[model samples]
Target chain A: MLRFIDARCMLGERCIIREGDPNTKEAILELMDRCHIEKAIVYHAMARESELPAGNMALIGETAGDDRFIRQWCALPSYFGEYMSAEDFFDAMKQHHVTSMRLLPKTCGYSLRPHSIGKLMDLAAQCHMPVFIDLGTELTTDESYDLCKMYPEVDLVFGNSGYRENRRLGPILEQCPNFYLGTGNYVAHCGIKLFCEYYGAERLIFDTGLPTGSATAAVSLIGYAEISDEEKALIAHGNIERLLGEVRL
Target chain B: MDFRELVYGQKPFEGVFVFDVHGHIGFEQGSQLGPNDGESMVHTMDRMGVDGICVSFSPGIRGAWKRGNDQTKDTCKRLPGRVFGYAVPNPFHAECDLTPYFEEDLGFRGVKIHGNIQGETPENDPRYAHAFELANRLKLPVLFHAWMPYEVDRAADVASRYPDLNVIIGHGGLTFARDRAVAACKRYDNVFCDTAISSAPDGSIEWLVDKVGVEKVLYGSDMSFFDCIHTLGKLALAKLSDTDKEKILGLNAKKIFDL
Candidate 1:
């Protein structure tokens, strides 16, 4: 029996313009149930609080109650002071087994500290935590390339890098070897075919960014695009397995 | 396949004009909308079944320019049979003597105005009045970028002034009220409502047809920015006949834009 997986699924809504919408968890699960996604790492949108690690921990706590999925630590830098002395960052990383910090410097209005970034990288090195940064912000996709280059070991998943002209990202794909992309919204854009062909298909992963019915729709984009099933299987699950290594589940 | 065939399964979809009404051309390369190159829009129009459109953008043209007309010259040259591009003018660009450009250069049949996207209050801006006057003189319609609780009053004010000018209030369905568009259309003969992004739970097409005549309504799917097929699916559940659907789908736009 073979099981497929979506490594980059977020537990929260991806749209920044409007709020009060439902998060991506139920939507992701429903889309996954419809499209068959197993073993997704979900995050929370309720991280506006001062103590974001606590907010993230609360999400982890909520999902700890559920059997179908697992929650990732969504760290807000404002909450970093509460728990982030490199030691505490590792403690939370170990406790929550956080694979990513959903970075939002423009929306969160914070700096990625030299001290924090180094220690965050150390924890990522120690615990293998990858950070998912939404490139939908004011930061250009080329800037996303810079961020990925700065911390090459810590896997950076670029989301909403640009809506259609995502092909501009082709140069970055050629330059940055370790960087990966969150595939939901990206696949819908017309240039996705060339992107998969140019960048190794393994460098891409599927995401719903769900609650916008994006996950389910995105599945079809990957399913129907000119790419082969072998490449899609890598994007859908194999690449995630390679990144995270063997886990108990 | 041709535009009619792409949408309606055949050509000679008699007297049908499927106007996208809302479109963007020339978004910068590697940006969200592909590139600002010559070939982008022609490729988009062919794939989307958009026969004609009145386009405006968040960018592409500088603030104090007729970005709409700037985009029009290229779209017409590229997809001559498939598109009739609209000349977009904002209050900032002071070109009162646009008749020559309208007739000679751009050959635009209509005008597109985006108020909210540019972060302006069109009601207070007198520069738009100049645009309205030019449209009236040319016997051309104006399809305005609008939404209720934001740009409704501006739409009504312009529509009331030029009774013959076909003023299309782009997104008029109030998520709250049923009679708002009806009351506005009743107030002005030129004003007509487009059932756009307001294709939500409350503002259904049946409610719009009940408020305004079927002739007054036009269908538009905000593609690239929205899922076109899914949006078309939403209207499939509306309480209207196949003819009503056909008219809304293409015929009404044909009549409205004179395609």
Candidate 2:
């Protein structure tokens, strides 16, 4: 059996949507078990609409004793010292053992363009860390393209990209090697096969957008794809694993 | 079972009997995509191990209701046991008669109403009353293309009016429509939601089962437009017990459509 790692999951109650269950660590672990995911990289759902430090702390507290989870900190712009300076932020990540980072520029009041987040992007690039941005929420395709160009050394993964965004994503894949796609809601027919054929499996990572998306659906896309087992392994866990291993923290 | 076996093995879904409640047949100019003919649909079904499908004609739903219905009947005739027809009635065209299609020999198992495509007719629109009445009279389940909460509410309204009619909210009311879709099922005994494109926010399937009981949820793959394997995999790998999985996979659909 191929070991699976979910690249995206949330760990707290979402403020806006009160429809589903609260995403506590126990709930996520049970979900991972249900979908046969071996490990997950999780951030707190509160980060999408709350203070970054508090949300990150909540995430740290929730997964303090759990090894199955890899903590991802929600980052904010360092304007007026709202978040820490780039250096301090990196140190905090090391201290907290956070392997990945996510940015909600729109909800958190910032922009992906260098003018707003340039220093942070530079720090991320220097540290060889992965930064995740969600499509339709934090950034648009063009904005993601600009960020990828600005920080070639920083690995940027775009999450929550559905079928409608594929046509727009093709140019980014062609232009930016540092740019990657999170396959949580990627529902295009034969999308995994086509993605691997065009951009290589290393640029695609497995993510379920869990607690808000289907892990099995994401897994089935890669598992049942016409790609080879080696490619499946890379997309399923190896690619994200390689990125996490390269994290300076 | 191994992941590979569950997905790509010879009998990919060996033990489960999958009955897809939402499917489309024949091509539509608007979508400009489909292997929508019967043979292509069956070919895909065989590949995915879909035991059966309750299908409507895409062109029929778009505009050519009668021609599309005739084409669906022919397709169902071509593949009797596998392809079950859903009669599409254009409420805008009152001349559109659905009576003959529901007859015993015609083999239509249900009715499909698209409010979005059919000029956004509310479910309570008097023009649709005839079709709903026919469905109630024939004991056929009605599948409504519900994309919003209001659409689901309209379905609940019509369902309440015709107590015997089984109303299925297609796509599980999709996107922002999920909460209301669940409420509709909880409110009406005859209302059920199909798991077609509802594979979002992780535990939604388990949540739905928990809220409304497994019996109120049915497995539907918006196939040809969407992948059957994707929806099937969602249900197959959900956290529900095997009994619940069995019901969502085929049992509920089998009981609802009498297939």
Candidate 3:
């Protein structure tokens, strides 16, 4: 069985959940076990949906003793005094053992430009921590290109990719080497194989986008893809393990 | 078939009768796609052990009616049993006639009505009445790209109008319009939902099955647009019985498409 480490997952309850979605942490774990996902790099629902600081702290409390969940905190540009400064946030992250960061620029009402998020980007660059963000909701494909260019040092993993993004994604994938894609919703027919042909498998990260995302479908995409087993391993777990392993903080 | 084992083992479902109801072929004008041709789809199917797939010319839904359908016909002709055709109807073209594809067993299983792409045409628009009439007469399945609640309602209207034909509301099962799709399935015997869409949550399918019984749900990959493996895996590992999984994967589609 191919081991999986879900790169994009949310912890805690969120508003507007459907009937049978894995909303609770326990439910998410059950799905993880079912899908054979050993670890999931997760952030807090409250951080993305409502409060960033409180939700980020809540994530630390939620995954306290569980090594299965590699913790990721929601990041906000500290231009305003709304949250902790970039330095303090990194300090807190190191203090709490949160290895990665998730950006909610659209939801948090922050700019992705160098001026707004430069300090955080610099800190991330200094540490080589992978920055996580959603494609459609947090930013557009064009903006993702700009983000990769803006912070070339920080590896950006964009999730929530639809099947129709190949046209926009092709140029970006060719241009941005730092850009990595989450395999949760990028279910284009033979997309994984074609992507492996053009772009190497090291760029694709295995993710379920759980709670709102489908772990079952996500695993099946990589599992049944017409790609080589080595490529499958790179996408399923190898790539994510390498990315998380590179975090200096 | 030990569906869960297949998923966990990362093995193709060789023994199970897998047939996809919703599919698209030909290059998409709006976005880039992975190998949107008949042979490429068949190659993927072979790798995944999918028995058959029903596809429509994606560009045909919006562009020239004759050429688009001709493309589908050509593809169907190229791959006989593995690739089935869905004759698309262009709402703008008044002289549209889908009878020729149906008249001959050109591997055309059903009629595809993607009204949303054909200039936002309503699913139950009068222009589609011809195709609907043909499907109604032949007791064929008419697949509609109904993603919204309004679209689902319009499809439900078509189901009500032509009770003989089966209306498969593509992508409506897991979209925001799921409740509407479920309601339609409950109300109308002929109206059914396809498990398409790339962004649906895991349990949404189970909820859909719970709301509208397993018989009402058919496995739709939206293949060539989306990969069939994910949806197939979803059904396999779904918190449902093997019989139900078998039904959604191909059994229901087999009966509906009369394969």
Candidate 4:
């Protein structure tokens, strides 16, 4: 069996579409089992639409018992003490055992500029935690590139961006070694194969964009990609495992 | 075969014939991404293990309808059996004539109508009715690019009017509109859905199959616009029985297109 560690998944109720199962821990796990995903790094779906503290706490509470799930919290600007300060957020992450973080700046109402997220980025860099930003959501590709440039030590993982953005992403990948791409929406023809060849497998991580996206499509994109097994395994689990292992929490 | 076996190049479905019902030839404006020509299309099909494809011309959807149809016909003629043509008719074009192409000599399998692409909406347009009428008269399936519920409903209304005209809702009405597409499929026997979008939100395909039998669904890559392997992978990884998978992958297309 090919074990997979899905780096992107959400847990909570989605307000827009009521077709699929509720984005609960049990439901996510059931989906994982059905899709043959062994482990997953999860965030709360509420984080995208709700306040950061409430959403993050719900995420921590809901995913308490499952060690298979690597907890991911939502990051927000520290303006007016709405969210934690840089040092405080880092401490909170350590205390809560949160290994990774995602940003929804647009939905959460914040900016990706240094003035807003610089402290968080610095702390994340110091602690070796990976911060995920979806292109066209929390940040555009250029903004993400700027963030990577500012904090070269922080590992920036881009997700939810489709294959068409590859031309835009090419320069970012070439310039920033600390950058990574989540393979949830990388559906370009020979995209995985080319990414593996050009950027090495370590820069790519397996993700399903589950609940919102297809776990089957995610698995198939990597599994059917004309790449070697070694590369596949690395993208499937090793890269994410290594990133999680480096988390000081 | 298991997912692992299929992904590992086992060719578990060696004998099964796969037909891509929705695909495109030619190029899109301002985007140079794809197997635009016949040679590249064949190369991509070979790589993805697709036995055949029913293709439309992109230029026809934009403008220059006749030239694009001629190009598609020529490509299909050059690669007989492997390549099939979908005559894309610009309903807005002053000289939109599809009669000759539907003849046996042309060997075009179906007609493609893009609602939003041609600077017009497909619902309640007189040209669309005429085109649908032409397709109904010729007893050919009409693939309609329906990205919303209203479009699917409109197509369904037309299909209801012309019971023999098989109208396929492309991309399964995309993400937000899939349920509506499924509803349309259930309501109308002549309505079918194709999976061609970039993403396959969880349980969407399964829901389609469960709501409307596997025979109402067809495998479509929307290739050149999208990757064939991606759609193939989506179908391959769907939690379906091999028999159902076979039907959705190609058997349904074969029956619809008579390939």
- Candidate with top DockQ is 3
Best by lDDT: 3
The digit string of per-residue lDDT tens for model 2 on A105-177 reads 8888777778877888888887789999898877788788988888888999999876656667888999999
True contacts kept of each: 0.10, 0.42, 0.93, 0.42
lDDT string, candidate 1, B3-26, tens digits: 212222212223444566555555
Which is the leading candidate under TM-score?
Answer: 3
In model 1, which residue pairs have backbone atoms overlapping below 3 Å? A163-B32, A164-B32, B68-B88
Candidate 3 clashing pairs, residues 3+ apart or interchain: none
For model 1 chain B, the run of ten residues with the poorest summed lDDT? B1-10
Local accuracy of candidate 3 as per-residue lDDT tens digits, A44-120? 99999998889999998899999999999999987548789999999999999999998899998889998898999
TM-score of each: 0.66, 0.88, 0.98, 0.92
User: What is the Å distance of residue A42 in model 3 from its true position?
Assistant: 0.6
Instruction: Please list the residue runs of candidate 2 whose C-alpha ends up more than 4 Å from where it truly belongs after superposition.
Output: A16-22, B1-11, B25-44, B66-80, B99-107, B173-183, B186-189
CAPRI tier of model 1: incorrect
What's the C-alpha lDDT at position A224 in model 4? Answer: 64
**Candidates 3 and 4, the one with greater TM-score:** 3
Off by over 4 Å in 4: B1-12, B30-36, B105-107
lDDT of 2 by residue, B62-106 (tens): 778899899889888989989999998888786988999876666
Q: Rank by DockQ, descending?
A: 3, 4, 2, 1
